[model samples]
Target chain A: MMRRKLKVAVFKFASCSGCQLQILNMEDELLTLTDAVEFTYFLEASRATAPGPYDVTFIEGSISTPEQEELVRRVREESRILVAMGACATAGGIQALRNWLRLDDVKRAVYPNPEWVKALEHSKPVAEVVKVDYELRGCPVSKERLLSFIKQVLVGRKPYLRREALCMDCRRKGNVCVMVAKGIPCLGPVVQEGCGAICPTFGRGCYGCFGPSIDARPEALASRLREIGMKDRDVARLFKGFTGWSEKFRKVIDELEGGAR
Target chain B: MVSGGIYSGKFGELRKLFNALRLRGYRVIAPKLEDSVIRLKEVTSFDEVPYGWEDIQAPGKYSVREGGKHFRHGPDAPKRILYPPRLELFRLRPDWSVEYPKERFPPTALFAIKPCDLASISVMDRVQGGIGDPYYLALRKKLIIIVENCVEPGATCFCSTMGTGPEARDGFDIAYTRLDDDLVVFRPGSDLGVELLSELNIEPATDEVLRKYYDALKNASLKAKAPFELERLPDELELGLNSPVFKEVAERCFGCAGCNMVCPTCFCFDVIDEPELDGGAVRVRVWDGCFSYTYAEVAGGNFRKDLWARYRHWVLHKFAYWVRQFGVFGCVGCGRCITWCPAGIDLRETIKSVVEWVRSRGGS
Candidate 1:
């Protein structure tokens, strides 16, 4: 008896396409992955789209427009299990920085006729429109982690994803602490792990591309940054970068600003 | 029998020791600067060790400057070589049979290690050896630990407070202190160290050279301030749990687990299974820490969900609970955690906060 291959779909909304590019970057493991699953609706890879209820759907990017909002809802209805991939689908990505500015102003800056553009007032993660079964987070999802998630899903087991700070990975790699050793302001403490602490290992601070971890204490980290000579405005700006619209970072920035009064 | 007395080992004898160890079929592992950070790596020659280069480390600041006589302990400990970041436990074959990985402990000599790290090895010996962990036991059997007595302790060192350093009293094969370019003193702790010293044909130190070496050790001790008042620490820490101090420190904690990973005595791990296409699996153990959200998590609930609670647990386990569990302080006061922490949250300050809290509550 032959086992039926799992039907999978990859969708993109509003993003830099880096997350989808990561899937293509799986050149070595792509054949192995294809053996287990049928990529039914991956537009970036194949022109012929297969329409159906997919066993699993990997969604990249955020719901930034009315059409995207409708598309995500339909994808959710069609997919049995929907996994949000990368920062955009998980926490709105760098585009979420627009949430801090007036939508009309941003639209006018980008387009000649602001009213002509069909866009939502604010970019939102997939979870805002539909429930996400699991999330693989990073600027672009880590290749190893993404593969692990797929493996687990295939075996009908829950994927093991660590909800810890980037500092954990940095320490595991035995990289000298950039913030502590170099006096560089790093966001490793507040940012979620999965980038393998790449920035810190390279002597730069983490920019929180994975968003906040479980119960991330950005306020505490913020105060420490101030103690280490980071200006309050800069500290606030730090929390407002990629994945800034997420609850933890948004609340942290709000609290820091509130404390200024 | 090895007698424990200081002997004069010439400054140029290090290259000889490296060659001697290599000749004896032992790979020498020593500290070397990589990407401006000192790391423990396998070395074939004495030049590989970062001699005459000391790191200037402070709270959230470190720099490797040239022309310093002290060879400080970098963040890498000997445990990394022995325990390793990842260890394969076993492999599950397609036939449903399990195959245990073969023990591959190499004949190795860990050179120029610190006294605090030597103390950590003893603790690990008790923990892993007592439990009969084959991986650790095999590695332990093959290791020839050669430590350096602290002539100039780092800015973050507090080994004097922990009573674990400035000079290694035991557990190492050979312990030596560099006095200057002209003089070096060696003390043998084991029969192997004595044999190595004799094979190198090292000359005995005069009382005058020994006095200078001891004076350097004393000077290193005076430089570090050991903040822990160990006698009242357990009681104070227990009561201070409800105090506001834990929250104060937790406020600065990014939950990075840097302290846990760098600390010589920390021994926690997580095991995972990677399944293959043929229904086979490779089981592996990776380092883990309490700072991770999943560390205390279980079905439907997490115990130490709050960052402050987790922070308090780490401190208490090191100072209070460890004595009850292992009869040894978990922290060797190496200050690796303080130096490696991104936020520069010093454990000394946190302990002081606990002391202050204790004082506020009628001086426990």
Candidate 2:
């Protein structure tokens, strides 16, 4: 008897679709992946949609719309394993930036028909509404890593990954740190590892695309930033970026403000 | 074989060795003085080595100085040479339709490799080789390692904690420890090493010579300061995930990924399709870092938007999560992160604070 292929579905709600693109970007691995799994639903890659009960469902975007909120619940109920594929689905993502702003103002700016526009009060990750078997964090997940995750799942084993900060990779690569050599501020000591330390190589700093790492010490990092001559506003602006709406980051920003007040 | 396994030859013999290797179709690369840095470059002779040079490195300064004697390794030489700033894996076109030729790679030998560098290769092997990285494997396969045991240890040298050293280990094909009287003792590790020894017609090592060589290495290791004790870090980090310490650290983090660039074992990468001016394109992978705000962001939005969360993620991944997943600590105890951090944030101190926090919270 021939073995059955794993029925996989890729879903997106409110996102830049970069994570989905990362999947498409797996040029060499795509052929093998397509052969191994049945792509029953992936709106970006295919217009043909299949309904319900997928073996594995990958949710890429956050639930920002009321319709999406219900859709996520249905997807969660229908899938055997639900994996949050990017920052938007794992965390509130960039839309979480709206968490700090007035929701009415955002609606008015984006919708000429504010009366017709219907959205959730707050944007939230898929896990907030549904159970997620695994969460792959990143603005755009690394294709190499995504492939590894898929392969691991296919092979019936937990994925092996390094959960260290980017600083660890920075040290291993032997790049002269912008923080030390150029006196540039760097989140490397704290940011999660996954991206291959790219920005710094190209003379840029980390923007915290992977979401708050497990066990991050924002208080200590705040004091260090002050020592380097950064002001409270700068600190707040820094937190208010990609995952700016993350509860932990918001709390730190609030603390900085409270201290100043 | 001659006595003491020592080969006493003039500096001219070094050039002759390179010439012979070149004639045999091997590329000889060694440290050469370039832009005041000891950079690895193709060499034809001893004249190309950074002779009579040294460097001084401190908290935020690096400078090259002249040595009084000829053919002596510099004291303050930057270790950055061990890890190249950029290494081409394989170039691809933008369309992902084609890959570059693979014929440019030729078997080569890196002469005068320090024991610290040799140890770094072993660490890299575990990351790149063990992880199914064909690019690193191909580059590593065609190279021969010739190590020079540390005759002089740098102030920042602490390979002892990492179990690396002033002495060579299993990775090297041959090891050389410099001795007084202009002589060098060679220890062969593989058949190639043995053959090289035989070709050079070196003497057998005497008990006294071997004793002296080991004694010097041991002293070098001893002279180095001990790294901060971090036995409780992994557990401490797991419990401190919700602590304010991460927030504090993130406030100062500039989000620069310099640490990743200088690291010896980081293997994360991004694949991009580069289109030539012509129609064809190649898909290639380049190094990437998670410290950037966009590392975890999807097209819709970023997840680790906060610098604090990103910062905390890095530390936890290295010390705690990596161990839980890979059955080995991601860190090799190299002090490059601490020494190279522009903000002067030391990982040792950061981990120690976590340990203290865990103990205070009754979690340790």
Candidate 3:
């Protein structure tokens, strides 16, 4: 039952670094976490760095720039298990909304000299660029799930993640079905069950912060929205949120917006 | 509160049963109005029950109004408390040894449960007959069921059609029909129920009171609609696989699994393994539904990838497959799925549409 200390690293790309901050927020398990896995290349937590060839590397955020794409490729090559954390690293996050627009137009509008822009034309999740062994999908990444994943990896077991719709957790919490009771158009049916069905419990519709579930039915949900008086454009805009770049949601957005809004 | 225990007070006093059960170390789970929904929750006092509140339900709409006559079934059913949405199965050691949880639950009494819900439990029992769920069995052994006849059924109620409700004939310890005069006529179905009734200084229900209760029950049974042509449903669903109604229903469905979660019979679940920091893993079974996309998924591919297929699977299974599997109808005609559907997709309407579609092709 003797276990060797595993080397762990947390890297960031084109994100707000909120997912990395979630790691620090795990204060209760911080000591136990460090004891299990030796921190190797996390710049956010410590200045001291360990060399490459790490056992597990967690990449948080999307690759928006050519430099970031190349760095993610190198990180993938160096790490044994590259786990994508957060919506950005898993489903392109909110930054992927920029993928819908022309990159040249965006560059010209933001910068006077468009020629100076060295970023990739599209902001993409880490999985789109490199092979991800596992994904912890969420807007900022669930700290509890991250801790569980790390422990499972350390024990040579599979991490448990609920891939059901948000409604499952919402019902388990005994929250009155908001969509049914209040007539609110909720994305809970198509959204992944993480974040503990937070938004719906708080009396707000899910904005797909955890991204779409494995077999989400955005088109079907969109039809419900339309039946409930939401315009096609509005439904499209709803899907154009955090996980807009995900295939299922992207297809829904395209159909609702007729490929261009 | 009376001198001679529960029966001494008066005929139709529900407080007696409530008090007797509580005194016997049973936690009474009753319908309590919370957050604008009548939920099946634990109640400590009789005042906690929404006595006068009447629920008005329609497709995609539900509301409560004061001065209503009879109690209507709410979104919360007995399944929520009994089966539960999430249950811990076992734990795994670093050596991969399985360790099942030995936690004991409190003695529970489901108060005022409707006939349809009670019938659903029968169906569930049949489904779990061969290899009974240890967790469910443990909780069930310490459970008491008090069934309530629906003297005034809700608008969406179709239990009469299913021959499962308006009155509970079996699978319950005690059954009661609340009269208009506030007198509740009690009927004992078990030895324990008769023993409890004998302890109470209760008088036999008078002929007049019995007559009134029967009339009300009769009226409710008459109002009940059996929309499903059950004999034709199996053949209809089998032939109507390509029916456009499936697509129409799927269009409005969010695949939220709300219907499945609220259903008294659905027992599907997904197992989750949470590894502890100490190299131990806690395996838990969380509720899952066929409506969920991942429910039919495997490493190779998803079986019910399309929403239409998933919706069809849910409908056919409830109507056809369950009959073949458990020798009982999966649906007790409780109508929770209709009232709780965010899209207002009515199962009665859906079944009727399928029947009509089958008939339109000149087939019985």
Q: Highest TM-score: which candidate?
A: 1
Question: Cα deviation of B323 in candidate 3 (Å)?
Answer: 2.1
DockQ of 2: 0.11
List chain B TM-scores, each candidate: 0.97, 0.80, 0.93
Looking at model 1, the pairs that clash are: A180-B60, A220-B251, B8-B205
Candidate 1 lDDT over residue span B1-364, tens digit each: 2355778867888677778888999988998888777888998778879988989876656778878888688888877987887789999997879999875878989999889989989888877776888889888999998898888888888988888888999998998888888677888889888888776656677889878987888888887666666787887889887889898778777787878888887888888888765557788887888877787789976798887898899999999998888888888878888877777788998998888888888868
| Native interface contact recovery, all models | 0.77, 0.25, 0.76
User: lDDT by residue for model 2 over B154-239, one digit each (tens)?
Assistant: 54555665556667776776777666535567776766765665556455657787787778778877854444444666787889
What TM-score describes the B chain of model 2? 0.80
Q: Mind giving the per-residue lDDT tens digits that candidate 3 earns over B1-364?
A: 1122112225336787788889999989988888777888999987777778888888878888777766777888777876778888888886789888777689998888899988987887777534687777777778888888998888888998888979898988888777754567777777777766666656666667777777888899888785665666777777777778988877777777889888888888888778788667787877788888777678976787877788888889988888888788788989998988877888888778877787788766
Off by over 4 Å in 2: A108-116, A168-184, A218-222, A257-261, B1-29, B32-56, B59-110, B114-364
Q: What is the DockQ of each candidate?
A: 0.63, 0.11, 0.65
Over 4 Å off, model 3:
A100-117, A158-160, B1-12, B93-99, B199-202, B362-364
| Model 1 lDDT per residue over A99-207, tens place | 8778889999999888899888788999999999988898888987887777767776777777777777777777777776677888888788888888887899888
Q: Give the TM-score of candidate 2.
A: 0.58
User: Can you write out model 2's per-residue Cα lDDT over A1-261, one digit (the tens) per residue?
Assistant: 134777889998999999999988988768767777788999889999888789889999889999999988998888988999887887788898776677899889889988788888888988789888987878888776777677666655565455556665655454445555445665655566677777766667767777665445455566667777899788777766776566666677778778331
Off by over 4 Å in 1: A255-261, B1-4
Better-scoring candidate (TM-score), 2 or 3: 3
Ranking by lDDT: 1, 3, 2
Q: State residue B204's C-alpha deviation in candidate 1, in Å.
A: 2.8
Error of 3 at B203 (Å): 3.3
Best by lDDT: 1
